[model samples]
Target: MTGGNWLGLSGKTIVVTGGSGGIGRAILRGALDAGARVVVLDYDAKTAEETAREADSAGCLAIGLGCDVSDTDSVAAAAEAVAERWGGCDVLINNAGILRPGPLEDLSLEDWTRMLDVNLNGCLIGSQIFGKQMVERGGGAIVHVASISASQPQPFSGAYSPGKAAVAMLSRQLAYEWGPKRIRSNVISPGLVLTPLSEAFYKDEDVRRARERLVPVGRIGRPQDMADVALFLASDRAAYVNGQEIVVDGGLSQTLMGTVPRPGYSG
Candidate 1:
């Protein structure tokens, strides 16, 4: 679908953090295709500008702004910019995050703090800043990009799962607290997705196939998979859906029982 405005997002303003690349970028494009003006927020200003330039086209407005979601001042400035340019944001997608792998036993305090700052605190900061705009506008949707690992802990990922878990709960808290204000908060927990950051791992054909077999859908997830769902959650069609965590893992999360050795139970 190419900016058909079927999602009813035409003229709506969308702010996406960490949208320079990966699933965030996919969501940015999806929002543009839905006919919404989008603002890309990334730590790297140059890359963000380049991405915005690439995604911009006729009938669609997209711009890039440098931001560190964990920094209140930075996000506040971005929010102010959005307000000045397009009045305020209609949809806020918190997709910026980082992963530092290390055993919990040996994880450094610095790494742990950094992960939480970006992965957990970042979401809260964005919601608070942009959420006010949504409140002033009467109502809006907030989509947080979490990870399936939020529920299922992944070893060697320093603070990643913990931070994500916190993010899920924080989203729910926001939903309950802000629901009466007409602001809806939701989370999207993605499974194993192949993004630019993880592209190197999938370069090995064997590695790719091995991972694909784990998902019941028989394929590794692409960025578009998450983007499709995000578009829905951000649209008015999902007005009734709030504070829910939509797991886009291709049924991979349900395979835990199948992982157990059931000799006679298996057909």
Candidate 2:
């Protein structure tokens, strides 16, 4: 009864990328709430410090780090700092990404490459950089914040979907390669969350309601929904879970709208 909790993540040190942004903030808060010492690594210095201040107020051991995860040198420096401070990495959440929405024909090659670099390459870099330590220190967990777009194709969202798809696969590959060393890797794919970045779509009452109607749960997802599951995947509760994608989409993926729309509407 005096041992670690069932989840086995209390007092663990967690490194989270993009922790200054919407979903990233949610994840940072959630991880802290779970009794983890969290490092909020982000590209923006001000926002990172703000996040650290807020988390500190909540009695969480947190540090705001400014680093470009897409840059290998920057990531290496950050990793070194973390290693020097945290003893050894226990958990890493690769949540840094960009959403450059455009049709394939209209998508800029630069933007496409950037998306792949951040969304896909960022996860890979973080995993490999921190993963080496995880392997050496016995083991750890890696969670990638992939999107529901990875599984369900999105219209007008070009590079984002493909990059996320690769993220899913990348997680699986890491799990396979690092399983022997005890490092676990998994992906959490979230759907339509009400984050600030998503305000544009939800700004219109009709649009928000229509999109909600599409979800089987009759509502869109919240960041906490994904973060709760993230808490598990990162913890020992999911010790057997690896190389898998847990879709947190409010049951929307299973429900197809084209087939059923009540008895009144028909083509």
Candidate 3:
């Protein structure tokens, strides 16, 4: 996408966690296309800087910093860097996350804690740190990239679902507590997206088709799909959209009834 000022983000400073790749990278690119100065925070410093350099080639002002969102000191440093470079953050996208698959019966405490640290605690930490910048700047928007598993249980995914579920609630709590401070918080729950992390699953044509059949849209989601929504949520266009969870699942969540045995109603 070409850089433009259509979303009124021309001079805005947008910070995206996990911005080195996948949906996070997409959001970073989208923000850049909208003419916003973007910061990429990822656990891998080199990868983050590479992504930033790529964006720079497109004439966008972007910087990549190593950050472990689960760590307060790491996040605080990243926030400070943003403040030093851009003065303050206008938008923050909490997109860094991890998944550890294991049955609940056999799940280890370490795995559970790790999942929560990244998926749940990371969100809070990022919000609190950058949120202060927003408070000082008068107001800002926060867009969290949660999973559809937040509402529906995905068995064998250890603490992935529970952690995400908490993130949804956390978003609401932040919205309520910070709305008065002009800090709007919202979440985007995505389903079946094809990214570097999930590319192995889609490599199998049969599995890919089977998954696609389950979605009403007849295809899996792309990073751009999530990025488009993030762009809107972070932009002033969605100023009134707060404490809300937008499910970008290609209408799959609404198809649960199709699995039930409804005999005489064949259309």
Candidate 4:
């Protein structure tokens, strides 16, 4: 879509994990609209293929490859496929994650491990495998899709909070260790974004309004909000921006203390 002077991403190759839907899909669409070739790396073959077809139908260069982010072999194969097809990668968006919310005490060890495996470990795997390719090329960018849960704790979220918290630190570590190689690493923590997985919750008007109220912007976030940030971080515009976590929550996180008692304040 870009021909002259656009985000320095024209003709670049970007790989987005879990790109079949939700925020990942938005990122892929944003990249495609920015004239970048995108590869949808997802575990579900059907949805991945469907997404790829949709992109193609829209005149965007995109392909889908099934990948289980938690499995080493799966990630390696996906990287290899990208190497064979695109020669190498310019950006890697670690957006694949699983959230199994429940009380900590009631959550099983397996459940906790599963959450960490897909959320935290998956980031490491994708970064390591695809990062090596970037290191060989002497530079690249990685955008991890964490959540606001990483910073602010939420009750009944099992290990999701801990997993995302670890992902935040992991991105920083990658940024520090890989900066010398010119590879930039960053994090995008979204809050209250409606996706297929969470769309059902918004079915109730009261719940939707409640969520909007929590956000100081007076509305919930959209996938494009997070995607826009991801695109920025992936581009040269964010060359010096590394090891930083960008919260795309529409002023929600900043309102935590404000939600408390305000003796005489009644707006």
TM-score of each: 0.96, 0.93, 0.97, 0.96
Give the per-residue lDDT digits (tens) of candidate 2, residues 134-245.
Answer: 8778899999999889988887987988899999998999999999999999999998899878888898999999999988889988887877888789998889998999
Model 4 TM: 0.96
Clashing pairs for model 1 are: 3-33
Q: Alpha-carbon error at 13 in model 1, in Å?
A: 0.4
Single out the weakest 10-residue window by summed lDDT for candidate 3: 1-10
Task: Report lDDT (CA) for all predictions.
Answer: 0.91, 0.86, 0.92, 0.89
Screening candidate 3 with a backbone cut-off below 3 angstroms (N, C-alpha, C), the clashing residue pairs are: none
Off by more than 4 A, model 3: 1-4, 58-60
lDDT of 4 by residue, 1-267 (tens): 232155888788899998987898888888887888899988897788789878777534798999999999999999998899888888999999887889987899999999999999999999999999898777999999999999889789899999999999999999999999899999999999999988999999999998898888899888989899999999988899999999999998898678677889755
The digit string of per-residue lDDT tens for model 1 on 74-189 reads 99999999999899988999999999999999899999999999999999999999999998898899999999999999999999999999999999999999999998899999
TM-score of 1: 0.96
Question: Distance (Å) between predicted and true CA of 103, model 3?
Answer: 0.4
What is the Cα root-mean-square deviation between model 1 and the actual structure?
A: 1.5
lDDT of 2 at 52: 85
Query: Which residue window of length 10 is worst by lDDT in model 1?
Result: 1-10
